[model samples]
Target chain A: MEGEEQRDGSRGGEAVNGSDSPASLDGIEAILNYEFRDKRLLEEAFTDASYSPENCSSFERLEYVGDSVLNFLITREQYFSNPNLSPGSLTRLRAANVDTEKLARVAITHGFHRYLRHNKADLHQKIEEFGRSIEEYPLHSNGMIKAPKVLADIVESTIGAVFADSNSIDIVWKIFKELMEPLITLKTMKKHPMTELTEMCQKRNLKLEFRDRWQETKEIEVLIEKQLVGKGSYRKKLIAQNRAAKNALDNLDAFFPQFNQPCQPM
Target chain B: MEGEEQRDGSRGGEAVNGSDSPASLDGIEAILNYEFRDKRLLEEAFTDASYSPENCSSFERLEYVGDSVLNFLITREQYFSNPNLSPGSLTRLRAANVDTEKLARVAITHGFHRYLRHNKADLHQKIEEFGRSIEEYPLHSNGMIKAPKVLADIVESTIGAVFADSNSIDIVWKIFKELMEPLITLKTMKKHPMTELTEMCQKRNLKLEFRDRWQETKEIEVLIEKQLVGKGSYRKKLIAQNRAAKNALDNLDAFFPQFNQPCQPM
Candidate 1:
């Protein structure tokens, strides 16, 4: 496995710009504000499977480990800090921070993607689009927008690399704590639009429906009282449904004038 | 929150047998081989929602935290130890160790369930059944048997309680590392019967089907070549399916005798 990993590293290092070099790895270390003891781990973390399809480094495996580490860190942080939070709320809070979009935002914020050695053609475009979309929802879109998984994978893989090299979760937390800025607190976290709408409908004893027109128009139409209350569009059906729910929620005051809805959705 | 927790502790402490008393908590500590700073946390860990539903303790929250902690421990342990494993294999390996059945088995192995302060009548019966069923598959059933969730909950809640009280994952790991004996290593772990059968069918270019007679008979029938290859019964449909697959896989040698299957379907 070590021999194969080294071979993968050398093969991936021989890319167009030699991006997996020692100096290039140092840039990643600079971004993370932490150095690696096992330089190969860092290289492996940044080496996307797209870079070398045949003998790829353990990028996915590192992402897997990093995901579990991040989950543990976030769960521990939330469990202690928010002692009154129910398990359901804690789960959501942790998910908001560790999710693909949130981590992708982190990568963009720290320019972590610039160091990612991937030949994925649309990755940069997707990252740019995600960066632009996040401006509309400062904290999280809550499934309202499509987030390129590669951006998040790089973040997790790097996190995995850091944990693997340091072999200290505290060190990983210290470095990533700030990098993951404005950690989605319970105060900032909002219920996913669909969930809120469903609860509202349940409370009012009203029938709520989302008509999936995704095949035809890549949109989800929120229907209440057999009326098209809201419409939202996205390539992904779930995101489109969330967007539709958000649109309906925004128009609820005028649409359902008699309902006593909470003034602040949060 | 601390005030409420104290109140909950006292309320739950006044149970039928005083199982949540100081002495009982000490027994738990002895089981864990670790004492707690805030004894309330230990009490909360054992207090099931069924014990006093109106204003129960934070057992679920602790379970949530413990689940994440256990996940991280197993992931880190396996990631470094099994460097050759793919992310998929690593996931299955970790899941085999930390899943409800495995955790429930832990609770029963060391008599951890005796301390769980619950008025749930069927809980003991289910635990006994799970204990007996596990004797067949000593390591893990892989969804072959029904392991009562409450049993798993106590294990996780206790783990959470220990972590929260000690404020150290290492301490929790040290205590749990031994309790979770025969930690499902890659060597001992086996794939779910359903998954194995599906892979086998896909490899052999043979279409496979599972007829869910669960509603009528509480059983799943595995049909191959329009022949009833095997059948398995369980209350849970998925477990029934797994059992059916195990039955099918067990009989494949004598039934078909031509698939060139692995000698030991480990």
Candidate 2:
């Protein structure tokens, strides 16, 4: 395992080297319109462990800092913006904004994935597949899809790199806030499909059950009133359940023809 | 439920009127030596939902914001202090500092618990019990003890209060940096007992198992080579497991009298 590179990280196109070239790094700075005091931080932000040896891998650390920074930015922003919101609501809202899907979308939006340095060979295919998949649900799939975590990591790593270099949160937020387009505000915020489906079923007094077929078939079916409302398949059980919930929510009209108003698209 | 008060949150002494008084609030400011620009934010920081009606509860919201801020502060601090540390180690170290037990200890040390305004009737007894329990472990108990969450909440809420009032993380950190005594550094940080025990047992080729009897009697036992070496009882299964690990570690001499230098003090 140590002798072989993972080669499983992806770039946007078929471009190779997956290494941080100076020109690409400069282009990244140009796009963000923020110059790093230490260029090494920016390079580290885009670097992947598979591309380098064990001792010099820094993106994970940067991503760690970035995750906290991003969370803080969103939390602080949302707290003042929504004064009357409860902590429960605030938590859900923050999660929506900074969750893997949202940040991964940010990376794709800003072409951050193009700058990532990695050895993952199949990553290109995964990134493209994710890009195509997300077009179906513009805002968020609400856990219906399992995003490539690397996409989100790069966004956080960049945020971390900027925050570390400037040592100013205001600057970091100023740069990324605009980049994270169509921010999920309270108006745009939507409940997770599982939460929506559960509440909807409970209100209608329907016999709701998530039948687990994952072990045998990697599928989960949402049963409502003894009727198979929706089914989804995934390698992970939770994801399968979430997809099943989303499928059930989307197909609510099949169960209640008169009450055909499915969950509104955010 | 709406008609009656909770009367559950506690003050340090057996004081009545779980409502916030101006003098007590003033005392809080004096304790921190940092005045709030907006006194309402300070009030909100200490205010619990039970103290007021649903419309006016703000401490939870503040706590929400403060939590992210605290996380960001610690992550940033640790990132710089330990340049060579991996993200995995950094995560653990950050968790050690910001965990419920550590922050609760901070609250107890700084007397922040006294200013908490709530309706908890049994809180006084709980706080007193917690105060006495921590005497056994000076720095941290590492999940051996389950600290009252409200104590930790107040610390984060106050940290949030200061950050919100001053709008400067610098001031919040300056005030709280000293209050959070003996910050858990890489030098003092210890692994969770469950993790430690598993690793130690694995290295020594000891067939170790955590037998769960929590559903029956809230007990967990560590069985090594089919011998009951250590057992712990707690309301929470995870805590019981952790306690059992600690117990097993403590009784290493009993297990193996030959090589008996147990886990050292922090």
Candidate DockQ values, in order, are 0.81, 0.78
Sliding window of 10 residues with minimal summed lDDT for model 2 chain B: B1-10
Whole-model lDDT, model 1 = 0.81
lDDT of 1 by residue, A64-104 (tens): 99999999999998998998989988988898999988998
CAPRI tier for the interface of model 1:
high
How much DockQ does model 2 earn?
Answer: 0.78
Per-model root-mean-square deviation over C-alphas = 7.5, 7.4
* Candidate 1 deviant stretches above 4 angstroms: A1-23, A53-58, A215-218, A260-266, B1-23, B53-58, B212-218, B261-266
Error of 2 at B96 (Å): 1.0
lDDT of 2 by residue, B13-69 (tens): 332233333136666776687767788888888887778856556588788888999
TM-score for every candidate vs. truth? 0.86, 0.85
Say which candidate scores most in DockQ: 1
